[model samples]
Target: MEYMKNYKHWLANVKEEERAELVALASDEKELKERFALPLAFGTAGMRGTLGLGTFRMNEYTVARATQGLADYIKEQGKDAMERGVVISYDTRRMSYEFAMKAARVLAANGVNAYLFENVRPVPICSFAVGYLGTFSGIMITASHNPKEYNGYKVYGSDGAQLSPEATARVVSFIEKRDYFGVPEATVDPSRENVMGKDNVKLCDHITVMGKSVDEAYFDRIAKLSLSPEAVAKEGGNLKIVYTPLHGSGYKPVTEILSRMQIPYNVVPEQAEPDPEFPTVKMPNPEMPDALTLGIKLAETLGSDVVIGTDPDADRMGVAVRTNKGEFVLLTGNQTGVLLMDYILRRHKEKGTLPQNAAVVKTIVTTSLAEKVAASYGAACYDVLTGFKFIGEKIDLFQKTGAHTFLFGYEESYGYLAGTHAKDKDAVVSTMLFAEMVCYYKSVGVSLYDRLQEIYKTLGYYAEKTISVYFKGLDGMEIMANKTKALRKVDIREIAGWKVASTVDFLAGEKTYSSGKKEKIDFPKSDVMKYFLEGGDWVAIRPSGTEPKLKLYVSASATTAEKAAEKAAALLDQMKGYVE
Candidate 1:
C-alpha cells in the first residue's frame, strides 16, 4: 500500500471539477485505503473491483500502473514493438472514460500508442477491434454483469482473447515488482500527458481509433455466422423476436446486425439504450430470470416467439423460449449451450459440411449433451477447464494444426461461440445465431422450444443445478479457500441419491477413472472438486472465481424432464449442507 503513497499527482491533470472528486476520494480514509491497499490483481476473468482510490481499486493510478507495465513489456520486445500500438475502449461505468484515458496516457508516455475509443463500447467490439486493427493488444473497461458498484479492465491479446497465463503472469510480475506507488506526483502528469502529446507515441499502421466501421465489420461477420440468411430473408417477417441489451453497449451493434441480416425483430425500447444503471431490470443478468422479466413481459405483449438478452458488455447471453406447456421458461445456461450445439451439429450434418475433423468444446461444468451431440456426428468433443479462456485456448491449438475445425464452444454460464473469428464468448455472434436459428426453426414449422424437446428425446434428458453459498469479505475468502481444501481430503464420495463412479480433483490434477486407472489431468490449477456419479449424474464443487461464493454444479439424466428436474433439485438441496 505504501508503494502508491507518493504518486499523489495521479489524476491531478483532470479538470478542476473532476479534481474535486478525486480529492474527495483521497480525503475519505476508507476509500483511499481501499484504493491503496494492493495493486488490482488480474484474476481469471481479468481485473474487476469497486471503483475508488485504493491500489486494490479501479482508478487512474491503477490503470496507469497496469498500462505502464504492459507498455514496458511491449517496448522491451525491440524496435518493431513500437509499430504495434494498443486499442483502448470503455463502457458506461462512472469515470470509465477518464480511467481509459489515464491508461492510454501511460502507454503513450512509454512510447506505445493507444487508440482510445472516444465513446462507450461493448466488450465484444473491443475483441473484434484487436483482430481487425491488428494491434499488439486491446483494453476494455468493463465489469460485465457485475453490479454498478464495480468496473473492470479486460486485457486482450492480438488474437482477441485474454492473455495466456504465462503472459499475464509476466505482466503481474512487472506490476508487483515496480515502484508504481512511489512514482512522484509531480512527474505523473507529464509522464502520462506527454505520452498522448504525439511526440512519444506512434500509432500502428492499421491500428486506428474506430467507432462505426468496426461495428459494421462485426455485423458483417455475424451475418456469415447465421445458419440461414436466406431463410431469414425469406421468412424473417414471420419470425417475431425480442432482444434486450440489459441497458448496456449491446444495443447498437446488435440492432445494426439484425437489420443488415434482413431479420425482422423488435427491441425492448425500455432496455434498448445503454444505461449502466440497467434501469428496467432488477439486475442486468439473463442467467437470472428476474433480470429478463421486463424483456419477457415486453416479448409477451408483442407476442414474440423468443426473447434474448446480453450482459452489460455483451459477451454472455441469456434467452427465453416458450415451453411445450405454452408458458415462458428460461433455459439454464447449460440448456442453451447444449441446444446451440445440437442446432449447429444438426445443421452441419444435414448440409454435408460436417467435417471428419469437426470438434466441439465445452467446459466440464456444462451439460453433457454436448458430448452426445459430438459423438452422434462422429466428431470429437473436448471438455476444457471451466472458463471460456480454456475453450479459446483449444481454438488457438486447432488453428495451428487444422486437426479439427471449430464447430462450437460454450460454458454453462450463458457464454457460447460458434465461429473461429473471435476467441472469447461473443454475444454478438451468439445473438445473431440464435435469431437465425429461430428463423430456421420457424421455416420448418417448429419452435425452438419444440426443437429442444426433440433433442432431449434423442439425447438422454439431462438436468443440471447450481448451488451457491456466499462467503463475503477478506475472512470469507480465507474460509472458502479452506473449505475447498477440506473437500480434497475427503474419501467417501457418494452424495444424495447417486453413487460416485469416479472423481476429478482439479486442484491436485488427479482423476481416478472408474476402470481402476489413475491418470494425470493437465489443466490450469483451480480449486475445484468434480465427481461423476452412477447413471450419468455428475456433481462439481468450486468457489466462484469472480465472486466470494462456493458454487455447486449438478448434472443428472432421466427419461423425462419431470424426473430429471426432480432428481436435480433434490440432490442440490442435499448438497447445500456441504458448503462451509
Candidate 2:
C-alpha cells in the first residue's frame, strides 16, 4: 500500500538517533501502522502528538511543514500580513522553544515579522502579545494539560480570540492547498529573517533562539485585570496559601502576581521549576487527583488553609480547602466557577461597583448554579460552545456594543477568568482571585467548605460529574458515531431512578419539552445531547472536542449535597447502560 511506502519515506528523513528509534519501531507492523498512518491532523486547535517520525507524530519535519504552510498562507495575504506580523511563545514542554522558533522562522521567511518571546510564557501572554503588538496572528506551542509526551500549536486572530470559524476554514484551506513543502526553498531563506538578526533557522533547530522585548508590555496588559489591589494590600499576609504549577509555565506569572499583591503563599518546590517531563505529576491536569498529590501534601505540611494547582499551560486551576470539620476536600471545577462567579458579582454589588450592563458567559455544559446567581444580581448569562474562544468572541462583542459589560467567564473544566482584559482563560488572574477568596472566608471565621454549605443552604445544593469513554482509531470512530446516533432516536425517560423531564439535542439544534413543545437552538451544530430531570437536575453527552473520547457531563440540584452527588453518579452509571 502507498501508506506503507510513505511511512518508509518519512523514516528515511530522520536523523541518526531518531532514525534508529523509527527503525526499531518498524519491526512491529501493527504498531508502526498505528503510528504512521494518520499524520497528525491539525484541527481548530492545531497539531498535537507524541514526538516521533510518523505522520501522526510531532517531530522537527512536521513542525517545519506545518509552519511552512502557515507561512505560505500569510504570504498569500501580501505585505499587510508582514506588517501585521506573528507573535510566538512557548511553555516548559520539551522542544517547545525549538518549535516556537522554527515556526517564527517559517513566518519570517515569507516576510512576516516574528515577535518571539525570549523565554517560556503562559497562553494568555501569547494572546496578549498579539494584541499588544498589533500583530495579525499569534502562535503558542504548548499542550494545555496533556501528559509531558505531548505538545501542541494553537493559533489566535488579531482580536485575541482563537481563530474564528471562518478564519479556521481559511487556514485549513491554506494547509490543504499547499503542494510545495519539499519541492523548493523560499526566495528569502528563513535562516536570515530574524529581527535580532540572529540566524534562527540553523542555530535553534532543536533552541536558545534570540527573542524581541515583548514580555514587559505583555505583563502590563494583564495587569489591568486587577479590580482591588487595595483589598489585597490591606489583607496581605493574613491568610496562609499553598500553590503548585505542576512543573510547567505557570510558575513565573503566577508567582509574579501573588508577589505583586504581597500575598503570603508558599510554592511547592517539587513543581516550582519547569520540567517538560512534568516529573512531579503523573498527569499534568489540575482536575486529576494524582496531578495534585505533591501539592496537597505540601499544603498539609504548611498547615495552609487553601491549596491551588494550575495545569502546565496555566490556563486552568483546581483548588482544595479545609472544611469546618478539619477535613480537606477538593472542590469540583463547577463548584469553583460558581464560587468565583458569585464572589465577583456579589462583591461588586456590595461595593456599588456592579455595572448595569454587567453579564457572565459560560459554556453550555457548565453548571446552572451560576445562572441562578447571575439572575439574582439582575445580570444576564449567555451560554456558548465548549471552548474559551467562544467566550472570547462574546467579550469582543460586548466591547463593541455596551450590550453587556463582560463581568466573568468560566467553564466547569477548571478554566476561568475574572475580567475581560485577557480574552483566554487565565490562571494568573485566577490565582489572585481564588487566593483572596480564601482570606475573605478566613476573616469571617469560616473555611471555604463552610461558605459552600452556606451557598447550598441559600441556593439549592448542586453536584456535577464528568466521565470520558476513550474510543481509539477509525473503527472506534464508527462505533462512537453509531452510538451517538442511537441516543437521539428516543426520548430518555429515566437515568438511574430520576425521570427525564426534557431533552435538548444540539446536533439537531432543537429542544423538546415534556409538554410537547420544541424550540430552536441558535449555536453552531455540534453532536452533543443533554437531558433535564425533575427538580432541576441535568445530564449532557458529547464527544471530547480535543481528544478521541465520548464524555458525559451531569449536574444535579437537591436539598442535600451528599444526595445530589450520589444521584448524579447513579444517573451516569444508568445512562452508560441505557446507551449500551
Candidate 3:
C-alpha cells in the first residue's frame, strides 16, 4: 500500500513521456519490489543508479529529492553556509544537464545560491569549483564511466573532496526524513536563464554562471603540477600523442593543457566531440581495452608514440604505449600507477624536492609495487580502502597534523591524483604528468615500455589483475550477497601452491593467522577479504560499489615477471571458480 501510494503520486505528477514506463513497471512484481524496496543511498561512491522511473533509478524526481535533502542540510548549517552557496556541474550524459538544472532550482527554492557550469565539465572541476568559489558544497551530475543507461549525483564537501562517509550519512538522514513527492523545487528553465540576468524562475535570483573564469583557474592550477618542464621543452614538439575523451568532458582541458605546454598531440577525430550516447564504445570507461580502440587506431594512423584515453568526466585515464616490438599494448591501471609513482618520486629526489616526511597513499587493493617505489626514496606509503575519498581524507589529516607531506595517491581502477590541487582524482593533472613523464623518458633515449621494464627489474617484478563477475537485474543483489557471505565462511588454507599465512576479513575488522593469532584491522569496515600467502603473494575479494559486479584481486611478487604472472593467473583462476 505504501509502494502503491508513492507509485500513484509519481504516475500522477511525472511528465507524460515517463508515465507509460511507470505504469508498465508497476505491474512487474520483481522490478516493482526492487525499485520500491529502498531508495538509492550513497554507496562506496555517491548516489548512482540505472536511469528509469523508480525510486531506485536516477530520474528528475530522484535528483530533486536528493537536491532537496542537500539544500536542507546546507540550510541547517546556518545562513552563512546557505549564502556561501552550492556549485553545480554536469558531464555529457543523457539527463545530466537536466539534473544539474534541477539541482540548481531545488537549491534556489531553498534560498541558496547556485553556481552552475555553463557547459559540460569533468568531475574534478566540480571538486575544484567547490573550494575555488568557497561554496558550501558541490554536485556533479555524472555516472562517471558507467554504461549509457546510468547517471549519478556526486556530492563534494567544502574541502573539494567527495563527501566523507560521515558527511554522506548526515545527508542521507536528512533525505530519509523528506517525502519523495513533496520535495520543493522552483520552476526554472536552465536554457532561458543566464547568470548575469535577473531570475525569470522562482528563487533563481542567486544563480551565477561559472565558465571561462573557473576553467582558466582549474587549468592554471593543474599546469603547475608538471615535474619535467625541461623534458617537455626538449621533446614536447616532436612527441606524437593521440588522445580521446571517449565522448565526454575531457576534450577541452586535455587538449588545452597539451597545447599550452607546447606538446604536439592529435585527437581521435571520431571521439573528440561530446556525444551523450557514446556511439563509439560499449562503455565510456578507459579501464577496458576496447574503450581505447578508436584512440589506438588513430595513434597508429598518426604514428604516435602513445595513446591516452580519459573516461567520461575525465577523472580516470588509461594509457597504451608502443613496445620495443612496435606493438601497442594497453597498460593495466597498476602498471600506470607504478610508473607514475616511480617517475614522480624519482624526479622529486633528483630535484631535491623530496620531503623527508613525504608519503604516497594507495588503496589496499592497488598494487604493492607503489610501496616499494615510495620507500626507495625513503618516503612512507599508506594504504586506505578502495575509494579515493579515503585518500582525500588522509590528505586532509596530513594538512592538520603536519606528520606527513602528501606526495601522490592512486587506485587500481585507473584513477590517480598528483597534487592536492583537487581532492579527487584529476586526469587533467595526470594527463599532464604522464605526458611529461613520457617525454622525459624519451629524452633519455628510452621508451615508456622500456622504462616500465626497468622499474620492474629494479623493484621485484609485480603482476596484478582484477577479475569482475557481474550479475544483472533484480536477482543480482541476492546472488552477490550469498556468494560473498559464503566466501567469508570458506576455509582457504593455501593458494597457488603457497600456504596462506593469514587472512584479513575487512568486514569483521579482524585478521587471523594460521597460528590462530588474531588482530584488529584499523580501517573502515568493508566486505573485503584479503589472504596473505607465503612468498609475497596475495588475493582479495570485494563487490564493486558502483556496479553489479563482484571483483577478485590478485597480486603476486617474484624474482621474475614470468613467475609473478604464473602465480597471479593461478590465484585468479581459483578465485573465479569460487565466485562463479
How high is each candidate's TM-score? 0.90, 0.92, 0.96
Candidate 1: stretches off by over 4 Å: 1-36, 179-208, 513-517
TM-score winner between candidates 2 and 3: 3
lDDT of 2 by residue, 1-580 (tens): 6558767786666667777777787678776777766667776677788776676677667777777667776777788886777878888998987788677767666666776776778887787767776878888898889888888888888887888877777777777655323522224335543434332333322222333345556556556655555555666677677889888888878887778778878999988988988887778999897877777788888788778899888999999888777667898898899888887887788779899989999998899888998998888999998889989999999999879899899999999987765678888888888877766655556667877788789888888899888777745656777779988887778788788788989898998888889999898888899999887788888876666778888888888989888988888888776455
Query: Cα deviation in Å at residue 511, candidate 3?
Result: 1.4
Please give me the total number of clashing residue pairs in predicted model 2: 2
lDDT of 2 at 541: 88
Order the candidates by lDDT, highest first — what do you get? 3, 2, 1
Q: Who wins the lDDT comparison?
A: 3
Q: Could you give the C-alpha RMSD of every candidate to the true structure, in order shown?
A: 4.2, 3.4, 2.2
Q: Rank the candidates by TM-score, best first.
A: 3, 2, 1
- Candidate 1 local lDDT, 1-580, one digit each (tens): 4634632644454446556666767556655544554567775456888776556777766777777677777877755665677888887767777777767667766667577764677777787788887888888888888888788888888788888888887777777666544422212333333332232233332223446666667677766766676778877877777888888878877777777777777888888877767676666777887888887898889888888899888888999989767689898888888878888888888888888899999998888877887798888999888878888889989999989899899999899898877888888888888888888887888888888888889888888898779987545667888888877767636787577788898888888866767889987777888888877688889987767789898888899989999888877887777675
Tens digits of lDDT, candidate 3, 84-149: 999888999999988998888888889898888888889888888898899989899999999899
Number of backbone clashes in candidate 3: 0
Worst 10 residues of 2 by lDDT: 199-208
The lDDT for every candidate, in the order shown, is 0.77, 0.78, 0.88
The segments of candidate 3 whose C-alpha lies over 4 angstroms from its true place after superposition are 189-191, 194-203
